[model samples]
Target: MMSDAYNNLAIEFCGIKSPNPFWLASAPPTDKAYNVIRAFEAGWGGVVWKTLGEDPPAVNVSSRYSAIYGKNREVIGFNNIELITDRSLEQNLREITAVKEAWPDRAIVVSLMLPCEEHYWADILPKVEATGADGIELNFGCPHGMPERGMGAAVGQVPDYVRMVTAWCKQHSKLPVIVKLTPNITDIRHPARAAHQGGADAVSLINTINSITSIDLDRMVALPTVGSSSTHGGYCGTAVKPIALNMVAEIARDPETRGLPISGIGGIGNWRDAAEFIVLGAGCVQVCTAAMLHGFRIVEEMKDGLSRWMDAQGYRTIEDFRGKAVPNTTDWKYLDMNYKVIAQINQQDCIGCGRCYVACEDTSHQAIARLVDEASGKRTYQVIQEECVGCNLCEITCPVQNCITMMPQQTGKPYMNWTQDPRNPRAEKVPTAA
Candidate 1:
């Protein structure tokens, strides 16, 4: 149960006010007007309408989806070869206008993609603007089919194309423009800088990573085979959350793109995931694969949980904690070398599971030992402090939470890191680690 006497989750993104910061990403979840309205009813604050293109919508293949599973057979990764919205451009525009009129308070940003030519982008900007939608997000992240046609990831992969198309959209449309970037590129900052230079109001990241989830060993075909053949697709879901987080942090911490409003999009499935993005500098968070898997009702849990969590943390609003974690996220060269910690086993809490012992002895450092209690003839495991590196593997392997913990060791030495160490040839050495 949550009390209303707490923080305000409302946020202003790109000059548009959303009741909360949760928006449905441009995917299956926001493909139609009915879906968008239903999501809003379910407590989502906004939605990026499914990506649209010029007339003659692209045709999608049958069996265009696949899944990657975990040990328990839970779907952790999702793959899709589906192209942009296949509905007629006019029909989508009509629905967008109706949905926007019905829910004027909610943010309705349309996601778009088209040919590389400025004329192609120039042509659709006014049509989208006429719908009175809040803004536009260029969908340059779809990895598969469309890229071959010089659109989607094709435009996204090249910084020049991203900048050019973004400029075209800004020039032609009066609406705020957001450039949704792809993760396939070697450096995400390149495209982000390009978008900012092109006059985008904000940027949303981590559209999707290029991937082939699986291959059918028996059939010798890729996953979601469309009549004995398949192509690479965009991967999403919990499996991609780590990648998404790092990319978001990279952009948030980069001096070149810092202060640019970011709408985080990736494997965000719950309040905690959304909080992580916000703390890492997302003005708002968008969800897709999770909605596709569980349905729109999940937004209720997200809203309630985020509001309650905010209350507990003493945060009065989203801005209080947004980008709070950015300073702590830095390069390896800046990490402390003098600080040290060692693993400790809590004998009382230990269930005598030797999982940690086996893990440390075999795969990691030989820090844990299996011992027998002479009096009771009980088997137990203990950590050898001298050899323990505080890698946290023992703690991770221990099934009982808090059974194995890392205790800090006071080195009584001034802080130093690899960047300033005397042993390094390039660095002008500071005091070496004692």
Candidate 2:
């Protein structure tokens, strides 16, 4: 199914061939037609046009965002109370038609959301189809301000609603429909199965989450304060990558929706994040915060980096090793109990800055060694073989090239912790009365 001579850069998403798996997600930056067209020209595989709904129903406040900054005061997390496309329906369709005509190969998935009514969906499906875009992504995942209006997450939270809306779209539109699920629900699979049952060709998740990072203690307002007040807004960016990955894996591994095509989103910042999703069964990757944070041009690095890494790994096409790693993942109880590890320090490369020591001693287990010169009475730092927890913190904090390493632990006695290893004589599940 793969050819070594062929470039492995391109991947398929929702039955659409994307030049790269990376796509700009539906967010403020990719909302406009001008922005979407530029992104397609910038080597992006696709763009999900901002969520659009039935006419005259959507409104937005100008001052709707609040941001959380890092120590350097850069925005690390964003909060937005904005609603779906405030732009006119005619304008979006006209733009979509133009962009698709220009870039026929690039994916042009229009993200849609309307009232739960079937008539609303039936009324507009033909209109959207007239644009000749690749597909439609149901935007039932937006979490905050729009929920109260009985849209976004309001539709996503109920499985019946998800199934109902997806069926309507499928019935009305010949184009592939992707049901984007909300992360607010406890069980993601419920909505995922509902989408599948409703005849959705694919599903993408997860949309932004509800969050309020901090408060203005003195001013008595939340961090992303809009005129001295704020509410829970959809959070995106680098912070939510792990959450997105796990949820993607869950759906991929679940028997109910295991074969369902998934378009991974939430916090994909770079190529590695994109690759991880591919390995875990995502057909394509979506970007929002990363593109918004950097710029549309960042897709250049994403494409190049993925191509290089794939080449190095001997992958000639996107499907060569797709979902290859999923089989390797197993339940925690099935993990190898015999493996061992230790911290290995490269003295020549060691800067001896002591940041690693501070991190390990004050916070983590004091598994590091203090080397002493008996004659001169001077001391140096190293790793303690017996005490180290094998966390790799030293390797992470090490300033030098190869200062610290986590050497694998060969099979030996089982780790005798209260919870971890089965061979540990004392290990047992917490007791419950029969």
lDDT digits (tens) for residues 102-200 of candidate 2: 888778899998878889899999999999889999998999777887989999999999999999998899999999999988989899999999999
RMSD of each: 2.6, 4.7
- The lowest-lDDT stretch of 10 consecutive residues in candidate 2 is 1-10
Backbone clash tally (model 1): 0
State the C-alpha lDDT per candidate: 0.90, 0.83
Per-residue lDDT value at 27 in model 1: 88
